[model samples]
Target: MIQRDHIHMLIQINPRQSVAKVVNLLKGGSSRVIRTEYPEIEEFLWGDSFWGDGYFVESIGNKNETVMRQYIR
Candidate 1:
């Protein structure tokens, strides 16, 4: 939500779900929306994929909130 290629977000998921599932949902859903909304960008995307195949995720415990917030900022 912060930039075109990167996002700064905080989300809470169910304990049963894995982080990879969340990443896939976000990337897959956004890719569809982006391609549908902006047809012109199709040519610039890599092999019909808008987002890259990899992502970075970090879990911040309550004790590490300050450290994570400062790092992200």
Candidate 2:
């Protein structure tokens, strides 16, 4: 929730799930909800997709939890 341009999140998914799968689910679900709830956003989207196709994914690995939380902030 960093305005309409981007999102900063620190989500923990199951080890069996792929990052791309989670991303697609989140984006797709959010897009559908936004479109249904907010008709005005359609003008800004200009296309069928509410979000851009591109996304950034990173592995938390052994990074410190506090450090990651602060970074997202």
Summarize candidate 1's per-residue lDDT along 1-73 as a digit string, tens digits: 4686688766778879999999899889988998889999988867967787788876666657666666666
Ten residues in sequence with the least summed lDDT for candidate 1: 61-70
Model 1 TM-score on a 0 to 1 scale: 0.76
Q: Find the candidate with the highest lDDT and give its number.
A: 2
Instruction: Give a tens-digit lDDT track for model 2, residues 1-73.
Output: 3755799899999989998999999999988898889989888766788888899988889999889999888
Clashing residue pairs for model 1: none
Candidate 2 lDDT (Cα, whole model)? 0.87
Residues forming the 10-long window of minimal summed lDDT in candidate 2: 1-10
RMSD of each: 2.4, 1.3
